[model samples]
Target chain A: MDKALLSTRNLHRSFGGVHAVKDVSFHVPTGAIKAVIGPNGAGKTTLFNLIAGTLTPHQGQVIFRGQPITGHKPHAVAALGIARTFQTTKLFPHMTVLENVMMGRHTRTRSGFLAGMFNAPWTWREQRQTEAKARAILEELGLTAHTNETACNLPFGRQRLVEFARALATEPSLLLLDEPAAGLNIYETQQLSQLILKIRDTGITCLVVEHDMSLVMNISDEVVVLDQGHKIAEGPPAAIQRNPEVIRVYLGDEHA
Target chain B: MRLRIYYPVLATAVLIVLLHLALAYADATYYMTQITMSAYYALVVIGLCLLMGYAGQASLGHAGFFAIGGYTAAVLTTYNLRPYADAPFVSLCRALGLTMQWKDLYGTDILSFTPWAAFGSALLLTGLIALVIGASVIRLKGHYLAMATLGFGLIVYRIALGTPVLGRADGISNVPPFHLLGSLQVNGRAPFRIQNYYLAWVVVLIAMVLALNLVHSRVGRALRSIHENEEAAHSLGVNTYRYKLAVFVLSAIFAAMGGALLTHYSGSIGPAEATVMKSVRYVAIVAVGGMANLWGAMVMGILLNFLSLRGVFGSFDDTVFGAILIMMMIFAPQGLLRVPRLRALGSLVSRRSHA
Candidate 1:
């Protein structure tokens, strides 16, 4: 209600005759950590894609920061303060970890081609600043020692952290993380939860599409329950835990 | 801070300058002239390196831009205007402000303009054509992009061959020789190969410096990112399409400049100079030298050209070049310059205990 940072009005998407997403509507309140959870085929990822401009809906619209962003390209949407991490880590594999993070700062850097080519004073200053900021982020994520290592050479858990650092480099007001906890072990998941809370403390809104219920329930301020592409329930984590429909669909009848 | 980088660059510069002076004094006109042409080819290879090595774009139509530049210089220098009845295309160009003067209509064989003016005009014309081509075809990627550029090159070659005023398949000859500004009267004489050699070297130096600056810039980094993963770069808010177009256009301009300088030095223009095979030769130069290393391209260009001139390589230049490219791709795809020995050399010296 506090001026939702992102809102969707009956977003719909279809792949030929199969309806992938059906009239799904949701609003992500600004600065809140929210999660969308459902079965694998219940359209959680599709919904995230539609909101992030990766897929255009067959009907309805997505509004970000009070402006229509329904049909903007992914890069254009990202430029307008929406950044996402892929479900599978999409690190620039050949680049050094620092360089991979530095790419996220691409849109923020103010130097032009001529200035960069000439190594102008302003461009050099900006380059150093960006690198320093990238290093700081890596340090925070415990990846400072791997700054010069190529992304592909890092262990899987650490690669995910690098991906998060790269996403943070974009300085996004709204972060759309796709399964940030997938493939992460128990220790990594705990660290990821702490990281998410730290991110939330920075006053940035997060919409996480995750299947790790324990992680989601522990960190999310609010949870939106989806069953077959329609919202079945939405509330604080405690209330959602007792909701019968959520129990029948997700928590199992035995738990109920 | 990096003595390895500084010392080598300094030594290379000193050697080049001493060699140039020796050639000037010893009157080794032919070898100096060959070095001049090699220098121009090196410039073209530098642009090709940016396109193929860093951006991961392939082009087989660079010869088209090269030929266009050659003809542009030839037309401006020797045949600015032709008999009206014989050359309707020249007449049209004259009317369109493409050609600078209408000397034939004035019943004068000589039109007044400095050699430098003609050179500048040719370079400008080459850049304009490359801009148009780049805008039209840069949207394409992969083999389709290569085929589109190759088509453009063939079309330009055909135009140069068919247009009678443009030398009608034979190309124009007896170009006015280049002169050092204010120092000598070498125009319209036996080719001033020595002056042209120095001129070509100057152009090559400028191209090398420009390329070195570009590879270290943000645009260069953006291009390398796009090459690695386009979707990831876009998701990070990089304008991938615009950067691709910018590199394509810049590479074409460099190729055009190289062609213009080569034509001026040779004192002739030919359709064969801008053939599809010639374009592939440029690609091979960059491929063998290492795609990401600009200095490697320079070394390979000089080596390839030197081999060809020595008659040791003979007409088997393409076969030998192709073999080297294949070997590089298989054994050291990153290029000879990127071998681990070179990377370890600096660290070895610094770690004195190990050394």
Candidate 2:
């Protein structure tokens, strides 16, 4: 492997007695697009949460860029070059798309309450720089037309794009996207796959938890198949499609 | 960019001047007393607005902070330290110029802390208390948060009413005036009323300008992000807990500053200012002014408080505020200025041109 940018070792998380993620282990190479796919209740989302620091693993470690980051808070994880989007579109509804992107620049900026309240000269300069960077991100995502519109006013697919733009504004080395295609139409899904490819080409690693099989198969450089909180298979997208175990898990026992 | 920030500030200055000129022309300068008092109350509203509006934290304990500030200043400035004049702490305070010698109503010489010392102590105590309270409670959300803060307010109220040193029901009186500079002072005497009115308004304007700057900056954006969705903000590297706690302490300081200055201006600090009703009143004014609108809160803070101070609502003052709260919650939860109908009205007129 080309030096894994992120690795989960023997991760385990449970809600009550039911194991949501059970002794799962995985790794993603630097600057690659990787996908974790499974049926409902297969522990994919739970696994993502554990890596993103939303939930602490009962056992095991998550190493990012050679450093163990297990049990860190979400914000702390984000500050260390990991950014994520929620399964649901969690855009700031009342804020404009431009402002939403600007919020992602939070950790990158240094102006605090006192500097802000006093309207310090540096804060003004920082604000302008943040605005310019945000505008550039919006343009890259082709969301410039909707820059001034409130985030919630956008259609579901467009809102997803705005969120993607926001996550990009954070300038994270690794982006964790949760169900980016959930509410998107087929056309929008295709657009999202293209965006994901563009993101990967930029040398940023992507770890995506997805449902749409075709979207995953098309864009993912490698695929990890999860079943009942266990890693059933992991390989290139082509091999995963041909794997007998993945087929059985997808089509039931008789079909296998 | 600078123009966007300066115009509103300039306009507010003009408005303040116009209001004073109009009051003087109408021979209603007597109303300035209530106006001046309202200005102080408005300070509390400004702080609460940031908490309840931008930060999306409902604090029903702001009056507790105000009382903490007022009582700290009142107790320090009025408590006789002459008996302990030889004590090291008292002598240290004297050497530091923190203590002053003045005559009481009976012409007795009394040694106490100066207004400056009292004011500094009030803010320091309020900030520390706010940090402790906020650390424990800022993690809570919605009704849980509201109830927790209400409980804090009640505790402060009880302490103010039951603590003998705070004068129980009679409260603390004989608070000395705060000397701001060479001639300017926060005093309630008739000769100082006009100057005091100007002083109070100037303080309010400075606060407003600072608040404006805050809300228009990056910190404001982060606060609004937290308000919209805390988890998402956290995912984006905004430390939601730290922001909430910081804003809580800042708002508490603002409330305490208001309380301390008002106590000095009135020459008294009372338990009534610490009551649950007072906190609710602050909440009501913020709601009526539009929760997130600083200017709206400041205006309604002064207007509603002035009316109540002038006995406009008669003996039903508390009842009137309670009713206003209920009405605003039901009829215009978005606040008077942000009512959907108002926006619809504007759009309706614009649509008429198309028709």
Candidate 3:
């Protein structure tokens, strides 16, 4: 059996009087696409932040590759090979699409202040490689034509694609995408689903928090359902669709 | 470095030469003194540009760094060690060639740290202070950062005003000339005016090359990313705090470098150099230069400092700087050169060249 690549052990968090996430435990096996689905205010985004280190879990732990990584800062988590995208695209607006992706290569590149100021030969070589890598990522995402345009000027769908290219540029083993299909059109949503599956096939595990059931059910190998900060169901995508508790949470009691 | 960045640096060198010729033709070589001083002031502005425009950090108390540099050099090079010559530390410094004996105007013998020794210590002290301040200060954003730095500047100014060893209101005077190598030296004397002018410009041009290279490379991209969206940059594994602190220290060193050089050139260091108004003037110059444009900052730094030094603003220097800050913030926040009309003109020129 494949060991879990990332696991949460009874993760718990609260804000003021409200419990954002309580006793949430799940595992993403290596090279699998796992989706966390829930209704509004169900703690999906909070859970995502906990894993990405934007928020600390008041209880329990986040384990990656069999090592505890709870409470690590966002940048430290990123350096440890966990990359994420925001629910609302947060690309550097003034930067070009290529530059935005190049930024993702920050951890991978080692040239810093002294080297940059002195124009060291190795920095020049590293920069050339960084640009080539960014361009390759853009080309793979079919964003080559838009690479030079400012990120804010791109169409919303293309902007989302750029974010994907940026996350991919980080070359993460575990990628966390928060609502990657949120504002996308139906066609864009379909393309995103295919892209997620393609990413999984490329040996990068994916843990996605998304509202679009079709996209999740289409690409996810397994699904975990949350309702009001508690796990309601966990199973294969087809099993999740038929889970009565998930149905009740998605629809009201009358529909159930 | 890219070949393109070399062009501007070369052009700046050529312009420096032409300006000297023009001044000689007009028999206005006296103006070279002010221009040389402005070049030193430009060093502080470019460093501030890196902090404010690129790294997205605001330092309202940069004059504090300048004053720290000036005061360090002033206090070290001006204090007479003749009385303590028998003391172990004084003798050690003297044995290390760090002390110089010279005659004051009254012809009395005085022993103090050499200008080179004083300059080195000034840079080291300024860098250490910036590091401590930045460790906590760079965590602040926007107005809070500005206010904190301003407070720091005020404290330095107060110390300069109240301290006895620093000369208090009288400041430090009769600082000896900085002797670089045989005959080549930094002093306000008439004979060395032309040489000092070239010396100052060469320093500015070298700083410009280093700054331009920094802004175009990987570190530059990281800084711009931080400026645009710090959260996003952090999530990409950029250590934003470390980068901010590093730039802060580097910029402080730049200001101190200018301070040390200027103090030597003018043969005096004063509490006025640490004034809040002086700090405000630097911010105004950076704003006018277009926050992110290094070349623009250098140009505006020289132009504004020269005008102010030549008494072009008469007695309204502080008022004029404050007004410029307010006006730029309200109207052309992108800076004078980066205003839409000029930006469009710039694009037009680029397009024509391409055609």
Candidate 4:
């Protein structure tokens, strides 16, 4: 049996009087494309934050590669080979696209404050390799033409592409994407679906939070449907499509 | 370092050196003195660039750190609290053929430490203080961070005004210049001010190189990452809190070193050095230069301070700085370098209003 790359055990969290997440438990097997889908206010993003270590679970454990990371900070989780993207694009406005991608490579590199200030030879070598790596990702994603443009100036869809490239720069074993297709048009969405499959082809596991049901149904190997902070159903895409609870969660109870 | 990559720093250095020679040849030694003094403020502003501009940790009490540095150097270079060799404890040591660094000569105690020693200790002390303060308050964002630092500055100012051991309101005088190679001394000698001028610019040059390198390297990227979006930077393994604290400490050390240099140059230190307004003045200089641009800080810090020093604005330097800050926040928030962009924006707004 394939081992789980990431697993959450009995995760529970509450903000104020509202329970944002409740007794949520799931496992992502190695090299699987898993989709977590829901309507509004279903705690999908909160769940992503918990796994990415942005928010600590009120009760439960987040295990990555069989190691407990329940209360670790975001940077610690990133260092341990998990990378994620925000729903709203968050690129450094002043830096060029290449620079923004290179910024993501900062974690995987070894040049520290002292080495940077002094411009050590090893730092230079690492920087060259970093730039080359960033350029290759840009080229692969058809972003080479916009490599030197400031990230803030890119069009909305391209900005999303840049974020994907930046997240990929961390070379994570598992990538968590939040609302990756929230605003993309049909062509861009199709391109993104292809890219997600390509990423999975490279053996990187994906845990995607999405609102686009078509994209979710098309790309997901396994589906987890969430509604009002509870998991309504979990199974293969075909099984989830037929589940009455998930149908009721997406539609009205009368429609179900 | 690649000379090719550092063209700007090299060019700026040469330009400054040439400007110095031109002023000397034109017999404007007094003007040169004012420029040199501005360099000290420029040093403080550069560090503020790293802290506020790059790391996005706004501090309004940098003058407090400056005061701490000046006073540390002043007290160590001028006063002696410990009894000398002829005193009972010291005499016993001498009777046993042992010696201590703090010597008591016949009952009079004087400061025996070199100015360089004082400078080094002041730097270390400021780093330690900044570490504590930064660790405590780095999580405060925007105005809260500013207010916390402002309170710290005000407290330091009041303490300096009230403490007699720190010379109270009058401060300490006759701070000796640092000695190099055991014999040659560097000080702000009036009529020429040659040594002080070179020393100040030399430090500025090194600060610019280091600051530029820091802003361009991976650490620099991490800092810029935090500046743009703290949450995003954290998720990318930037360790936002640690980087903020580290940059804050580094900025404090720079300001302290500059303050110690100013103390030695003026040969006196005063409680006025700890004033809250002085800290805000530094923020204004960096703002006018450009946010997160190190060279802009150097140019604007030196120019604005020189103008104030030459009595161009009389006693209204504070007013001028305030106005500049407001204007920058409105018209040129990207800084002086982007004034053309601001003009374009202004025209666009005007066109919309006309329509």
Indicate which candidate wins on DockQ.
3
Candidate 4 stretches with Cα past 4 Å from truth are: B81-109, B182-184, B338-355
- The two-chain DockQ for each candidate, comma-separated, is 0.53, 0.63, 0.65, 0.57
Candidate 2: the clashing residue pairs are none
* lDDT per residue as tens, model 1, A1-256: 5389998888889888877788887889999999999887888899998988779899989999888899788889889988899899999887789988888888788776677556577776777778888999889888999988888899999999999999998899999999999999999999999999999899889999999999999999889888887888888999988899998887678877
Interface RMSD of 3: 3.1
List the candidate 1 regions with Cα displacement exceeding 4 Å.
A226-232, A243-256, B1-9, B21-29, B82-108, B112-132, B178-180, B184-191, B330-355
Please tell me the TM-score of chain B in candidate 3 relative to the true structure's chain B: 0.96
Candidate 4 local lDDT, B1-355, one digit each (tens): 3454467667877997898789879988678778888898888999999998888788998998988888998887776634574678556644653332433335444634567767888999999999998899888999999999999899989988999979998998767676655444556678437766777788899988888777778898889889888898898898999999999989999899889988888788899889988998899888887777777788888999899889999988799988888888898776655576564754442221100
Clashing pairs in 3: none
Clashes of each: 0, 0, 0, 2
In terms of DockQ, which candidate is stronger, 1 or 3? Answer: 3
**Per-residue CA lDDT of candidate 1, range B200-280, in tens?**
666666677667666666677778888788878878888777778778777877877777767766768889877777787
Give the alpha carbon lDDT tens digit for every residue of B4-107 in model 2. 55566678779878988998899888888888899999999999988888888999899999999999999999999999999999999999999999997788
lDDT of 1: 0.77
Sorting all predicted structures by DockQ, with the top scorer first, yields 3, 2, 4, 1
lDDT of each: 0.77, 0.90, 0.91, 0.84
